[model samples]
Target: MKDIILRLNKLFESRIRLGIMSILVVNDWVDFKYLKETLDLTDGNLASHLHSLEKNNYIHVRKGFIGRKPNTSFSVTDVGRKEFKLHLNALERLIKNI
Candidate 1:
């Protein structure tokens, strides 16, 4: 129970980060504005979380140009996808036990 709780807690913690991660998992690529709007986060707040995920190698950012305008997209890497799934499963197991 403790182990299951720990895993659930890890994912439950860092709400902003988990939100960003969950969003990235669903889309192949997502823009900053989409994330900001979806999460209803301020610019600075969203940026900070995105940076943390990038640093942790849980997410990747691609900066490029769209019609000569600068664009940034975020996506979760394979490692991140796997981790998210594991955490979700941990929660499921915990729920099942109870």
Candidate 2:
């Protein structure tokens, strides 16, 4: 139990961050607006969590313009995929133990 707990990634402790990762892992690219709508979070709240994931290199951000409109999208990195899987496995083990 302790080992599984220890294996959990601290960066993914927040439900917001976990949700962001869960969405990113399955999708190729997700825009900021889509995430905000899906998570039902304010722009500031979502930006803060996105910044954390970006800082950790768990996600990749791309900024561009769709004609005159600005577009920002996010995708999961290789490290993120691996770490998230590990964290999920740890959680699964802990749950089974319980």
Candidate 3:
């Protein structure tokens, strides 16, 4: 339980990263537009946060032209899914124990 708690704490170390992770857990894939809309973040703000997550290998980017416009999509990787679930489970366990 202690080890799980430590790992979960690491997973949510940053505010923006934590929010991004929570969103990814629920949605298989999300668009840049959707993330900005849902989180009420500016373009630069969202892009930077997404980049951080990508750098950490927690999320993957799929960029392409949607018709004539550029579109960026994000999907959580397999490792990310496992870690996020573990974080969630740890939180639930800790709460239940309390």
Candidate 2, lDDT over the whole model = 0.97
Candidate ordering by lDDT (highest first): 2, 1, 3
Question: What tens-digit string does per-residue lDDT give for candidate 1 at 1-98?
Answer: 88887777354368888888888988999999899999999999999889977877788899989899888999999988888888889978988999
- For each candidate in turn, the TM-score is 0.85, 0.98, 0.81
Candidate 3 stretches with Cα past 4 Å from truth are: 1-4
Residue pairs that clash (backbone atoms under 3 angstroms), model 3: none
Q: Compare the candidates by TM-score and give the number of the best one.
A: 2
lDDT per residue for candidate 3 within 1-98, as digits (tens), equals 67656757574666777788889878988999988898889999989888977887889899988899999999999887787788778888888877
- Model 1 off-target regions past 4 Å? 9-12
Model 1, TM vs. native: 0.85
Each model's lDDT comes to 0.86, 0.97, 0.83
Highest lDDT, which number?
Answer: 2
Flag the better candidate by lDDT, 1 or 3: 1
